[model samples]
Target: MQKRQSAKLQREKGRARRRRRRIRNVGAISRSEVEASTVADPLCLNNGIYLLVRSYNYINILYSTISLLFSVFLFNRPSLSLFILKGKNYFCIVLAAAMSPWRIMMGMIKEKSIRIEKARHVFEAKEEYFIQNGAMLLEKQITCNQGRDTEPIKIFSAKEIQQATNNYDPNLILGSDIATVYKGMLDEREVAIKVKGPTIYCSTELMVDFFLQQVTIKQLISHKNVVRLYGCCLETKIPMLVLEFIRNGTLSDHLHGQRNKIPCQISWLDRVRIATETSYALCHHPTEMFLRHNNLVDYFVLKMRENCILQIVDDVVLSQGSNEDIQAFAELALRCLNNKGDERPSMREVTIELRRILQLVRSRDSKLSNEIGLALT
Candidate 1:
């Protein structure tokens, strides 16, 4: 009876051990399923976050590109810039509707401000000019007793003229004696300032006539080729005449002075053109008057009659033009010097003839160039 009881106790202990082993296996499987679900949830969350960040980066790049393009377009169109400034509130509303970034809208506002300032400056400058123009007109009527039929000439102050001419420095003298011409700056433009000698202003009456003469000269002539009389300063003991500065010196300088000293020569075509232009200028004078000096046309005619025309032409000029062209040019100069003014060709006729001559010469030159090019090829 004791042996049977011990065997039953051992069988119950084995059943209990088997039940504990099955419970341990089920717990391990459940823990593994829970870990897999946790890993899957984290992976899905990470993917969504990455996609959102990438979309934000793309939107930023697109916004930057659009802002750059719009800035470029606005920079070239000043009227559009002005319009934008005029309608800033409207533009702000439009930008807000488009969901424009804060940075881009701020940049446009700054640009609009700059454009408004620039426009204000321009308007102020124009207003100043109008005021000056009105002053000039008033002064013109006071000085000349003339109506407003002509453009008003400026009346420069004595101090302003002195400042421009550096107190009449001797070194700045362009011509001297009867009237001294000095290089000067007026209104930021280079001008020839001619100050009359005290001899001309010996009496008050003579000074008055001199001033009137200047005004009459300015009013009568308005030719492109003639030297322009800009304005004058009459406050000084001897009045000053502010004339247009010709870069190339006077016709006399080119014909017989400084230009002759140089080895370089003037061409025959240029000489003919010069003569033609001078004749045209003389012919167009308001009054008929012969020049006091031995006329240039007469000198050329004398040379032609003496058969020394070649001597009159520069060595460089003789080589370039045809003898026939030179002879024709001399003959035309002679006819211009006819003793009777009525016999001379009109300025209009002279201009037309010179233009015809120039066209013929150019055509000949072009043909010569083509022949030379063919030979070179």
Candidate 2:
């Protein structure tokens, strides 16, 4: 019985010690888990999330800032506007991604609306100018003079002429005087565009009336020597005329103006032919008008009066022209340049005389060529 009680006491002591150790181990484990959770659970997770959110915000801000700067810079420069418009597709994608899609869309819509409004205003202004420039009256007269069967003068749009002339670049200018002439391609055909320049001390109404009359007369006056009037643009304050493209320069430019290294010189035969053709064109003009006086006419009168007209002839004409033919031409020119309109030779008589001179020159040339051929033989 003593041995049994001793053994039982020992066992009880062992059980108490094991239980204390288990309790201590469990408390240590619980404390360690609490400390680990405090360090790693909410704090680490929150800090990592905060860093990620901050980086994302920075990226968004950087993107938006870059987009805004590009937009402002591109919009400010007029020269770069074309580039921006061309690359707008790429820019739109970047802008939409960097900024709010809704805001970007709204801004684009507003810009589009503004452009449309501006275009509408421009169109209305062009229409008003077209009406104010006597386009209606011109159209009525064209219809009346040129029957429905004949094609009337084409009325070109302002945009068409502008595009044709590359906005009237100075480099493409052919001539400038009462009107500026531009060389351009219209409807796949070479055309000369004549835009009247602003004149000083000119009444607007008188100018408009004069321009209207000139256009009407040109439509009625169709001769081989006269440049064909193709069309006109009335969409501007001053109407623009479209004439046939003459590759060669004008007679005045060839005769008196400084030549631009042209290879061909006008021969005496060509001179007489030109005079005949000019008289043919003048025959179409009103016959009852007074003779137009200019410096050339005055010089001719002075030279003829002095009997020194041959001295004033071009070197080419002096070399090839016959004295008799020159005398006849001088007499005809004097008659045409008479100060009194009624005393001057009518255009019909002038044309006939010029033709006779041209025929005589051709006959003389043919005889000379025949004689030269005989000598060669």
Candidate 3:
């Protein structure tokens, strides 16, 4: 009986020990979670701290080196003995130390300004190429559109069109499968001139109707996100559309790294903004304007609906944004890509949602900046 009682007591003691251990583990887990919640984001915090310290150190070293150089110059110079004897050596050293950093800063600013001007000049040269070729046509077109409520859509003559494209220079061609797009000048503006392929239609009437419909659609769309249609040339055997030149090229060029020797890395914020702007354009006039370049955007929508946004996102942009923002954006894109056309959100709704998302991101960034500032202080 005593042996049985002792064994029971031993088992009860083991259970108590186990219970205490479990309790201790739970407490530790809770404490860790609390710490995590209190800390905004460890990675961001650490990065901020590191940058601040690094910049401070750099500035300190720069000033110290400048001061040392001034001291050496003042003490080593034999020709300035009279000036030094006047009790002005220390004052000269102080001036030199202060002016050195200012001079460096001014030099950097001047270099940056020169670079900016060079870039601007390059862009203007591209624009000038178009202006020089279509000077006469531009004058005529401008005269015709003067009294119009909206920008006048001028119909260019075949000769003017030919001259603008340099007789359809092969080098100026942008795309060439079912249709050909040539970079051209219209009304002193850089324009993309799209000409339909001859094999697209068997009947002349059908081709004419298609071109007319396209012209109508282009004329109707005036959204900022949508590319502007300057006019069309119906005088040619195959009609051509004059569209505004978007200097950055297509989104595909940057996203897929095509035609670009140096791949451009698009950031997460930029990707989101692109998606938002695209959706805004797509749903802007869903019933009226059908995009000529709908294939890429449609493909992206399909991939996003499959929850493949993360898979398709460029590697450079993958690490830059919060996952929550990405997921929310993907969800919104999916909604716009819904199979049921009736269930799809309108352009207005998409615009509102995108604006909200952008605001949220900006607020979060501002909050983080404030927190980092406080931490540094």
The model with the greatest lDDT is 2
TM-scores of the candidates in the order shown: 0.48, 0.61, 0.47
* Superposition error at 273 for model 3 (Å): 2.6
Give candidate 3's error at residue 82 in angstroms.
99
Rank candidates, TM-score, best first.
2, 1, 3
lDDT of 2 by residue, 261-330 (tens): 6544667898899889878877967666664658788888899999999888866677888999999999
Model 3, 1-377: lDDT tens digits are: 99999999999999999986654333111223323322434452222111111122334435444443443243321111011111112112122213334345667999999999998986676456335434534444345446454545876766778899999999999877666889988778889988876367457656655655566556555777678888877554456778888887777777767586757676666766776676666664673323334776777877776867788765676677777787787788667655566777778888889977887777777898899999999
Instruction: Give candidate 2's whole-model lDDT.
Output: 0.69
CA lDDT of each candidate?
A: 0.60, 0.69, 0.61
- lDDT string for model 1 (1-377, tens) is 88898999999999999986654333111223323333445453222211111122334335433443354343321111101111211211112112224446677999999999998986676456445443543465566655435545676876788899998887888776656789999999999998775355367546545554666557657877778888876555445678899988876576555645744455556666776677666565532444434766667767888988878875566788777676666666666677677877776777677766766666777898999999999
Candidate 1 Cα misplacement greater than 4 A, ranges: 1-152, 176-179, 187-189, 197-230, 236-239, 246-266, 274-283, 295-300
Best by TM-score: 2
